[model samples]
Target: MHEQESTRLGDEIVRLVRMGARFRGMFKTGDLGAEFSALMLLPPLRAMGPMRVTDLAEFKQADPSTVSRQAAQLVKAGLARREADPADGRASRLAVTEAGVQACERVREARAAMLERALADWPAERITAFTDLFEEFNHAVEALLRTDPTTPPREPA
Candidate 1:
């Protein structure tokens, strides 16, 4: 890619990221009646099965204590529960509860509805092409994160 094209691409990506951050806050409509920040832990716990706070922190590249507190909130909200780790009786793993799964689905539905409306004017072919390209882009980014010494693992999109 030309230098100018590369710069433009970077700028556009940054703009989209900022917009995504904004959209993140817009979904907090009390669908789950829990703190939005705490609920942020649901998806990972759901996807990862059961995990320790330390493991969650490592995967998120965040502080262990912070993740522990967040997980505690999830437990308090009944979104997640603590399960005894079979390998370590002293340690507990966090697992998403049925309520958490339902909440996750509701949130996803809202997000998908919003995205559908946002792209309502786009042609079907354009949408299909964008989906394919976006998936490829995300895979390339994940590959770079795995191989690049300076790149860090991030939560999936």
Candidate 2:
């Protein structure tokens, strides 16, 4: 890409991210409450089964303290539980509860429905093309973040 095109793309990505955050805030699941920040931790915990705060922080490229606080919220909400780490009796790992799984599904369905309504006028082929391109863009960004030592850890915007 040319320098100008790269600059434009970067700007658009920033705008898209900001808009997405706003849209996410609009989604309210009864199980998780209206605060989406803490709920973000559920997906990784759900996927990884159980993980220490530090491990989850590293996986998410977020601060360990932040992850710890979020995990606590999950625990308080009964969406997740802390369990003894099999390898280390002294340490505990956070695991998503069955409620957490259901909450995640609800959130996913809500988001999908919203997207479907928003894209109702778009052709199926266009939607598929956009999805493919968006996934490619996300993978490229992840690769850059992984390889670039100078890249800073992500924080809530």
Candidate 3:
């Protein structure tokens, strides 16, 4: 990429990261009363039905031990349940409970509503195009995270 293009992308990425941190803090401290770290597990569990800690860890690119602790917290909060994997006598899968699903839905709706308000001035076509591009960008990021040497060394900020 050209230097100017790369710099603009880096700046945009940093801004997005900062905005995400702000939103996370807002949700964690508000009426929801759930920590962002723990709430993060709900979406994957909701989507995947049930998953082992190792499976979640891989999917999240997180450490197994960390995911284990998060899973324990989720279970303790009654948001998730651990059940023996019938196919594997010794292993277990963590599944989101009804409460977990509701919580996830509430959070998702809140996020969507907020974004809708933020983008209310934009035309429908622009919003659709942005969504499509953002999804593609996220998949590119995931691929980069999974592989070796996806990009050149970063220039100092």
Q: Which numbered prediction scores highest in TM-score against the true structure?
A: 2
Residue 143 displacement (Å), model 3: 1.8
**Candidates ranked by TM-score, best first?**
2, 3, 1
RMSD of each: 2.9, 1.8, 4.2
Model 2, 1-157: lDDT tens digits are 9999999999998897889977886665654752477777888788878999889888888878888888888888888899999999999999989988888788888888889988999999999999999999989989999999999868741
Residue range 45-96, candidate 1, lDDT tens digits:
8888899888888776667777878888878888889999999999999999
Per-residue lDDT for 60-154 in model 3, tens only?
77777878888888888788999999889799999998988888887887778778878999999999999999999999887786675755533
Evaluate model 1: give its TM-score: 0.83
Error in Å for residue 27 of model 1: 2.2
TM-score for each of the candidates? 0.83, 0.90, 0.86
The 0-to-1 C-alpha lDDT of every candidate, in the order given, reads 0.81, 0.83, 0.80
- Shift in Å, residue 131, candidate 1: 1.4
Candidate 1 positional error at 44, Å: 3.2
Against the true structure, whose lDDT is highest? 2
Separately for all candidates shown, the number of backbone clashes (residues 3 or more apart, or on different chains) is 0, 0, 0
